[model samples]
Target: MAIKNVVVAGGSGALGTPIVNELVKSGFNVTVLSREGSTTTQPAGTTVKHVDYKSVDSLKAAIAGQDAVVSVLGSFAIPEQIPLAQAAFAPGSTIKRFIPSEFGVNTRKTPGSAIGKILGAKTQLVDFLTEEANKNPNFKWTGISNGHFFDWGLSRGLFGLDREKRTAKIYDSGNERFQASNLPFVAKAVSAVLQKADTPDDKTANQYFEIASFTPTQNEVLAAAEELTGGDKWTVNRVSSAEVQKVAEDKLSKGDYSVFVDLLSVWQYADGAGHAPNLADPALGNNILGLGHQDVKESVAAWLKE
Candidate 1:
């Protein structure tokens, strides 16, 4: 029940790197599960095992002695988690905890919505986790939903704000509040979850621990950016969330996956797309996870400097 040895899949990715680093800093025995021939170098103070994700037996063997498994697999490989989960729950398997990549939206409970459609693979894996956990009482799963990636996404121009250009695509009057988290903060939250699970009761098991640096509207972010870089230097273009949704849906029909970001915009900033449902419940452990608040100004400052 005490989680000391942890194995992380996709340990070289954007999100996985931070989680692995934080786990190392937290003094957990870390193992990274890479593909059969990954040439990527892993972080220091961690072990690496090359295994075929296609082979459940290989994955099970690689993670045989791990106390917990944390998955940071990309969206395209989301279905790959099902076999990994099965391997974890196999007879004689020692893995007690499984953390799937639920970092973005809360898609486990919204399979019927538009953003759900965009992130259907996440729902599929969640369903598999649910069934597996029900079959084995000792096996538990944890999800960390922090809405959107504020720092990473903003740096990559995914948050509608171009850090270099000083321009923003303000969606729908720029007043829709939503959840957001920085990379390091969410990484620390992962460490907190594992520490909480390193106990007899394990309160973090089978739960989606929601945490955020801060939740801010698009306009609020713009104001912060303007204050950092002067209002006159920044250009703003108001966009309709409904219109973006329409375009995203059309692209989805054509198998254009890039429209997924636009679909998320529909849910995050639109009027009736159920934005930030996790924030509705304050009882959820944000502070309990040792996650502290960060202002939008700080986020803007970081992104602008990046």
Candidate 2:
């Protein structure tokens, strides 16, 4: 069946706005499902549907008649899986596709790591979605794993880099390259997926699709920053994997996300060395998604301007 209308839960968020705009540009009648009382404005031609994440009835109403659903919805409070499953399996729905908010790290592979431990709840969401898809053939789900949001991380200090000082904290020797994607790349890939919904050759029912822009090392990032800023005036601080792991352990003992930090620490050291073979889907590489290789130097220059 051809996908015509699509819905996005949490469509008012930072990532959701771009996804909504891209979907609308691709000719899908887009519906933005915001939580009730959300103050964010919807884009033109996109309908705003108020749905409470806690209320299954409200979610079902907003999700009705959509060909597919995309969720960028997240919370440090609510377990997202329940609402996501409810929205996917909304009453009298023919919703064929679902894209979960699995946009960071290859969760399926890093099972025993700090991130895996900290994100145990999110992992359960994946398991639930898989089980749901298996039980109901009418529904399908895709988890897009884009390693880390490169530009977003850089801008937001997520990589422990100070944008003003042009300084970053590194793990190990900081020479290992790791995969990363920009927020725009993630939005484009998601939009491309929804636009090409009928063409299932590049998609699976309940599987993960990994995408990346550049796999640059921390040193390479520093070099790129220096080049972009017109000088080598940046600071680089190094931390060992063991130190990171110990910190993560201490944090986890205190019931925090130190585990996730540790996992990220391990990721810095391991790169893609310990990842699964099919983690990056070449079939969905550059063709269906229009995903092109990004220039890190140019991107950094632009970011510095912003």
Candidate 3:
């Protein structure tokens, strides 16, 4: 029904921490579950529980009285969510809503490519949660598929512009428009979804919601960077999206795990244009969620200034 007591797994992580803060600020009773041996401290005004992640019983006990379970596990730790999901929707559980850890691109529309392999676990979890929700009338799930984390990309040299190196690798003509959201916007989206969970006009139940702060092309991002840095021309390199996907696939086949950057480029430029699967969706849930909009130029200027 109305999601009040909420449990967040991996609440100390980069994206997870912000989501926790927003949920707390929104006045949702928050509980963070860390691994049994984790030394990280939980944020103030929330309860913390250390439990064995591998045990469904331990997870069930920690989340016994919660109304919703929001998971923020990273890619590597995604498999651990299976037990958590099982615990949340277990027979006689109080949990009504389950928000899985899918804070990136809409993998439901993901093409058959390297990025799909990287997101296989996420897709599996979505399917599992959907099936579980279908079986239980009271249980529902929501997936927030924000295109890309914009702020993180800017600071971490994603989107192919390395300000430090004054170098750029613009994807195919660099004119593809794809969805991207700042980290805090994503957190706000989550809080908004939870706030409307029990409303009469609830649109979040058993659905995958897509949101983005801004949808900008690679060239536009470069332009913003150039404008911010007084129009310094970046050393540019161009690569085909297909070739980048092939490279990432080849590297992954060889056990190299550093292919995510290439895969990100491939996802953005998958159609040889800026056609991210999420952007192609007919219905974007930004308006439905009451989330704030962010402009790319302002975001770039602020992040670059930092």
TM-score for candidate 1, residues paired by index: 0.94
> Would you estimate the TM-scores of all the predictions?
0.94, 0.89, 0.94
What ranking emerges by lDDT with the best candidate at the front? 3, 1, 2
Highest lDDT: which candidate?
Answer: 3
Write candidate 1's Cα lDDT for 67-119 as tens digits.
Answer: 99999999888888888888998999998889998888777656876667778
1-306 per-residue lDDT for model 3 (tens digits): 277999999899989999999999999999999998888997799999998888999999999989999999988899999999999999989988889999988878764767787788899999999898888989899999888899988888777778777778887878777879898999898888888886788988998988999888888888888888889788888888778778788999987878987887777755454445343344677877766467899998887778
Total clashes, candidate 2?
Answer: 1
Number of residue pairs clashing in candidate 1, backbone atoms closer than 3 angstroms, sequence gap of 3 or more or interchain:
0
lDDT of each: 0.82, 0.73, 0.85
User: What TM-score would candidate 2 get against the native?
Assistant: 0.89
For candidate 2, lDDT tens digit of each residue in 1-306? 378888888777667778888888878899887767888889899998877788777777778878888878764622754775777776577788888777777678767766667667667788888888888878788888777777777777777667787788877777676768887788888877776665645455566776777767777777777777777667778777776677777787788753664567566555345442232456644433667667777777777888
Pairs in steric clash, model 2:
114-259
Q: What are the clash counts of all predictions, listed in order?
A: 0, 1, 1
Candidate 3 TM-score, true structure as reference:
0.94
